[model samples]
Target chain A: MRLKCPANFRIVRLPCTGKIDVIHILRAFEKGADGVYVVGCMEGDCHFKSGNFRARKRVEQAAKILDKIGVGGERVKMFNLSSGEGPLFAQYSIEMDKKIKELGPNPVKVALQAKKKAA
Target chain B: MIIASKKPIEEIIQEVKDYKRLLILGCNECVTVCEAGGKKEVEVLASALRMHFIKEGNEKKIDEKTLERQCDHEYLEEIRGIVDNYDAILSLACGVGVQFTAEKYHSTPLIPGVNTCFLGANEQRGMWTERCQACGSCILARTGGICPISRCAKRVMNGPCGGSSKGKCEINKELDCAWQLIVDRLRDLGRLDDYEIVAPIKDWSTERAGGPRKVVREDVQV
Candidate 1:
């Protein structure tokens, strides 16, 4: 159960959230992530100005791909928060927990296909 | 880049059901970029197949590795010792990559995980659109840089035929007439008269019809 917690997310902290790329997100899902959500700095508040903007776009692209391949793109999400938004961070986790609960286990796990080679 | 789609999970599982030993191969090239085949995809596929077998009361062992470029000889050579370990190889690369994998490992069965599609461009993030046919010739420069062979339904080099309607192709209402794009581009460059030149019926002699083509560059020789 601990593995499925929002805290189980192996956070790859970046100097700025803008450094996160969509490839990373897709790779995460491919690694069996039940869901992925990028926490980025609030707009107009990014320390790197436009870095957060690029991160947002990357997350969106990853989400679209996840959607296309029947992985439920909603499983991949993005949230904007400031460095000191403790309450918001907690809220995001709680919301993620609920969303994962709704999604249940990963589809790949549920759709495990077995081989039937001759004995 | 060429785009391909992975077969349905059930379909792939069914296709490989008869194999007792399987080697799941991944490619780090085109299919990887298109989100079809890659290290991560191989993991997911392996995990899914394993789970399926266990669920059906039959357990099996599946091995996996990502080749740098299976189409290249050196990379294929890297897997030599273990190639004989598996009865069948599941290739998660494009068609060319799969063919090369089979060529190098003649005794093992090679199965493709992806349905190779046409050459395309990522028009938007996660969205791919076909843009080229590789008809073995070049005509874009004369048609205002838009590929008539690929963009036009009829591959017409003389501009829109009677099928063109209101700057759109009659075949596909959503498609903008390729000739319309050509004329518009020519007009923008103040060279609309360039469209007046009728191209001669293409000499198929220089293309694939001529024979298998090869490029030998002395400077790039190994």
Candidate 2:
């Protein structure tokens, strides 16, 4: 099947969504990702039984941490979809791309760019 | 174990906002089990603080460390060499750990990151409830191993107060009456006759009423 997503769109796969931790999501932002989203198995359908559920909780917690640091929590999100949902994955990519576009470049990235120019 | 919860991020931010270099210290004992002040929590907090400072357009350095146990002086000494490098120490331990850390490092300011809740048992994952008050008294044997001092809201010894109804305490309908539990346990143990003997007034001196307390074992003294 031909996969279609924005050229800039990046996907980081994991053995299971539960393997995705808060630090991974935050590090993406620290390293200048405008946004990060986790695609996990549908609720209760996780092969690991509760991996997706755990991923959702970690996403929510990571968002709160972002909000506490003046970074809008909406930049990160978790979406549930089965492995066969290729079209849905593209749709989520489009949706996230649009949201990130509206939010513009990540402030951390902008700050780094400015620092580079100053030095 | 000692139960605790993290303070609001805003409160922690306010405490360390003026400092450029800060250490986020955690304890691996009770706070770790409670998910309040463990290594994982330290990473989260350090990242949040860094993000906050970045958002404020300020350069800050936040370090993270988790001691084996913060309340013990030996564990605290591990940071003695590096303590002077930071402006302040943010302790994620219980109140005891915070106080001990502060007392040991008198020159550096110590900030508490968690509000020590109580001496309780972990009912389950993410759930804790108070169990012991450390009143320096143990009446569990006479009361069928049910501690009225900690379990009962009123700490009644002779019998349940008039507010007890259908085995529930008056303070909260959901709370089981301590005396009622004692009576039932006594029946199960075939010691219901012990309930007939009324307990006398407890001596508060054994507890905090005698001011700060300590236990010195002369035999163990070096």
> Of the candidates shown, which would achieve the greatest lDDT relative to the real structure?
2
When only the first chain is scored, the TM-scores of the models are: 0.83, 0.95
lDDT of 2 by residue, A55-78 (tens): 999999999988877787999999
List candidate 2 stretches off by more than 4 Å: none
How well is each residue in A19-80 modelled by candidate 1, as lDDT tens digits? 88766776566456788888888988888898888988878876665554556678878899
lDDT tens per residue, model 1, B53-103:
544555567889999888899999988999898889999999989999999
DockQ of 1: 0.10
Question: What overall lDDT, based on C-alpha atoms, would model 1 receive against the true structure?
Answer: 0.80
lDDT of 2 by residue, B1-222 (tens): 999999989999999999989999999999999999999889888887877777677758899999999889899999999999999999999999999999999999999999999899999988999888899978888999888988999878788889889999999999999999999999999999999998988888988888899999999999
Q: Which candidate wins on TM-score?
A: 2
Cα deviation in Å at residue B68, candidate 1?
1.8
